[model samples]
Target: MVKITNKEAICIAVLFLLGSNIVIGSGMDVQNDNWIAGIFGFAYFVPFAFMYARIQALHGGKDLPEIANHLFGRVFGFIITAVYTWYSLHVGALVLRNFGEFVKITTLTETPLLVIMLSFSVIIIAAARLGIEVMGRLSTYALPLVVLILVFMEAMSVSQMNFDFVKPVFVHGFQKIARAGFSAFTFPFGESVIFLGILYSLKKRESAYRIYMTGMVISGIILVTLTLMNIFILGPVEGDFYFPSHSSFSRIRLGDFLQRMEGTISVSYAITCFIKASVCLFVACKGIASVFGLSDYRFITIQTGLIMTYLAFILYKNTVEMENWVINVYKYYAIPFQIVIPLLIWIRAEFKNRKGKRPKKSEELEINGGEQEEAGNEF
Candidate 1:
């Protein structure tokens, strides 16, 4: 069904991982040393990423819902799939609200948050309607623009960096760094759990290990670099800005010729965020279809997108509340869905594989010298 090459899958993963982190910046609790926290966060998430990849390889073309139903039994699997579907929707809404808040506070000061969110929701719903294949192909193009934008932002602001801000390693002690690293793992890194919804569409199931591992490593580096760049560009007063990456980008100016670069960078953030929202919505739709025994997920894309828009509106009263929730509440709220349940699934998959339940090579046909194609799905 819905086939995508390993390259497309990895691109989507990188962009999805970069998503909101580009706008809000990650590991913020540690302030200037957030990069250190991000590095450790990536380290902490490495094993789990491999485990997730293994789950994909073991299950082959089976998406998470199917795997759950087969491994956990129908009733329990239905419950687990429902919970994960809800988590996907909830995370998508949180991200939609984040971008809405960013736009409202920054460039579109007068634009209604509802309008901004609805606009983005329409785009996301359209992309979801196009299905996973289209989404995967789209990432092949969009990710490069995002990468270029990040490079430009870093280069343009290179002169503004202050070496002094990086002094006194772990100035706030290891506790805060660990806390921030935990937050980083949960929010961005651990959230890769949602990939189970569609990564099954990957052309060659064996590529899951390479896809997940490579994407996470690249995204982790980008995230850590952005965090460190913020510290360097803003120096000791980096804490003064809520969106440090955006603030740092705003400082770039090549004598009025290249002024206001954050505008371009802001567009890049929106592109990546849009990809994240689209993937989340698409996954939620697939999960719903699987749970309810529907043939296709097309019918519910609009409904789910609108629902996400409304939930985003009611998610937080303002940016302040949202920021507080992300920094303090979201970490704990996201842990069970992203880590606990996924761990359960991984354990079961491993047990099944050991019990000779692994899918045979015949289940998937990889031919044409790796230029693979999967069975088509009209859905």
Candidate 2:
């Protein structure tokens, strides 16, 4: 029900697309499988980006749940909506956990993990409670700082770059590299599927394709460039170390006065993570509202945030356990819900169109006209 301008929608998409997931997830993928993972990751977005654009074009300013309801019936529609709602919360929790681990390991080693989580939950809940407009505005303001930190990190580390490190890039077997690519693509890029919920709020639906695809392309380029840079500076061996990008920043030295700038990346990542979490929280609420027929969407934020916090706590026993979950559970659980369900809805919409037998609410009302008239007469 909240109206947003095209520019605001684009900004939100960018925040959703290039959040802590890319920063932390990319590094995690690279650490797991070297630079090959980045390559596969980029490829994963190709179809995902197209699927999103196609679904938006077909629906024309409707969320996925609405589209599902149109093509399917209310029963199935509610089911799909519930699945998406769960998916969004699960993703929110996963990203929160990832960020919590990153901060605890890198910057705030002494801070209790629960304290960090509660702090993050408070910020995310606050932003979500302010509504989508504020979240979009915050992203517009924060994106520049995040980009600047990335640029500065890349610039300062330029001298340390060694192309030879990424050389023999396919030194790993093609099959292994391809598998890594599958993992990368699924984690950061395919996850963009969640943004479909907000596409209807854009002032210009036609521009959704251009804005989203462009954002993904830009995000992919950045991720690939960062992966290459990490490999160049840290070598393949060191790139495998946890938080390679942070480590790369730690090595920066600008005439001895501009040192220890690694925290700059951390600051940027924190802001990006906040925006990402906010967007996920908003989408989760929207999906729930659509499912339960809630008149006010903002009311669900606290309850959902609490649920998300508890889910994050239960998601992983530790960082290593979380990483294993990301590799195994996430791909299996997320892919079907994120990719398959939307694809089915889109296909059903088209097929129903071909049959010229799509159901409409007006038709349903007309069919029940006698009962309505009798009830009105009784009243």
Candidate 3:
């Protein structure tokens, strides 16, 4: 089996968290307070990382599906695995849809969504078939460049920023900020739970906690900083734009000659989205393979990618419906897989560990009797 170091795992996590986030900034409804909401959401996700780490620790090197199978019967375990597989597949489809929409609106106004999706699907399938180690290494190499470009864009935009626009904070009260926080937590932060599949490939299983936490912290900083940059540059109008980061970056004028820096955001977005979708696709393919006892996951990667592309087109009638579903339903809909099931499994694993540590009644009695005999002999 291929093994990934903690560093590679961290890179994967960072890019995965950035996947849709760079394209769709969180807490759009909360306006200027979106960055604050993101911070709170980051805090909310810390325990989840710990929980996922605990689950990893309990099982050593085993993935979530394997842990379920060991704790539950094969049938139930396979069912749980199937559920997670579907979740990954669904998420992959959503990301693809987001990509298609972004490309349609911004870059290729003339192209059909289906053709764009097909081109992306072919690329995604090819990447997924290359396997996890390749994906991890690609993230390791690509993330630094993408992040650097993003930072440069933010720096360039700083000259045009007006921090005054972010003034009069909390004017809308904490309720809206709290709601945005919840949205941030469920959509992106909680989505990290999908990393459970890739965690199995880590070379140092004991370092999973550190890897998860580090990745979250780094990505959280980037996300919050980007949001703040958007607020500063775009002011109250940030929320008005669908892709504020791109809009903000486009406003960056470098020396009057180099103006359109939106391409920086696009590059980072594409790279991050590729990493995120690839991870989801990899997990889905890998999980399905585990369920069916297949020796290789690549066997199904293309088929799954094609299905995901189709699902992307048909998932919503239009972008408005898609946005509505995301705002109204997605947060609640993702709970079971993200928090509920993992928490249950973690609880069960802890209970089993505690039970295993305790001596049986018969063993306790034998120990007492042996202690009494030892005392008599000493006397």
Candidate 4:
């Protein structure tokens, strides 16, 4: 039934949390203090992760759609599920578009972005069709390789890093750093809501708490380290670069031998991106299947992939537009699904639990009466 071990789940979660942030460089706008922003972002998201885990625990491995149905009833639950379904599909498309944009900017200048997106969609479709178990296993194996490459590259570039660049914390004041942290918190960290779709697939439902906390911490550390590396390597000019982590790696040179390790960075990016996209696609397919009462989610994977690929093309007209949306609009757009809806669900769950635990009026009256035969005893 598409079950996966906690380790596999962690792998998927970490990779999904890592996502394009490794390439996009989270909180880059804060420049030298981006690490601080990363810390704040991670801090802000931890509680939400905890809350999500609590929901999972309360529901006994039921996914979001099922939980919604149980908590909200048919009509409202279907509506909520529909919104979640759209969010999953929408986020998946945006991530695919991010990949397409990255390729078009860095590698395939001569090729059309649409073609690249479509090509990537094929792989994502296949992965989603294979089910969450296969994806989880793939993630378990691939995450380490990606992390190793990242650490190796970071180590090699260490010689070039200047610690001084990261100094003078809050030079632009705490406001800017806080804003960047808020932005960072929303895009990738808060996006963990999508995991609600697959949390039910865990072999041990209780592992949800460990999985969420561990995954978020690992990804947050990676993002923070990457941000620090960008500051150390690129310094003040880090803000000028779109993908600071990638740009930093490109600058790596050792003597007359080692140089230009963009390929390594590219491979790592592709691996993480593929894992993220696959998870999102799987979530979308599974959510849809649940909403429609389909027997299998695999039936809709390819069709959903096709639709997302097309949507990716129309998502943004240019890089500037995309960046503007990401920096300015996405955080607000994501709040409803990531924070608001989840908060509502948590509240409802709590209220229902309290209601169930409260004694009925008859029971309360009987207890208050304290022995109905007190009159006979007195006589």
TM-score of each: 0.92, 0.88, 0.95, 0.94
Across residues 264-303, which tens digit of lDDT does each residue of candidate 2 receive? Answer: 8788778867877887888898888888899877888999
Global fold similarity of model 2 (TM-score): 0.88
Write the candidate numbers in order of decreasing TM-score: 3, 4, 1, 2
User: Local error of candidate 3 at 70, Å?
Assistant: 1.3
Stretches off by above 4 angstroms in model 2 are 27-36, 356-379
- Tens-place lDDT per residue, model 3, 156-207, is 8889899988877876678778777887888788888888887888887788
Residue-by-residue lDDT tens digits, candidate 4, 1-379: 6688999999999999888888876534767788898898898898899989888878876888899999999999999999998998888898899889998899999999999999999999999999888988999889999889989999999998999998898886888888888888887999889988898988777899999999998988888888888889999788677677789999999988999987898898888888888888888887899889999888899899999899989999998888788878887898999999999999999888889999999998887686656866787
Q: List the residue pairs that clash in candidate 3.
A: none
Local accuracy by lDDT, each model:
0.86, 0.76, 0.86, 0.87
Better of 2 and 3 by TM-score: 3
Q: Candidate 1 at 25: error in angstroms? A: 1.4
**What's the alpha carbon RMSD for model 2?**
7.5
Q: Please give, for residues 158-263, the per-residue lDDT of candidate 1 as tens digits.
A: 8889878887789989988888888889869888889998888988888999988999999998988888898888875765576888898888888868777788
Cand. 1 TM to true fold: 0.92
Give the Å shift of residue 364 in candidate 2: 23
Clashes of each: 0, 2, 0, 0
Clashing pairs for predicted structure model 2, backbone only: 40-181, 41-185
Clashing residue pairs, backbone N/CA/C < 3 A, model 4: none
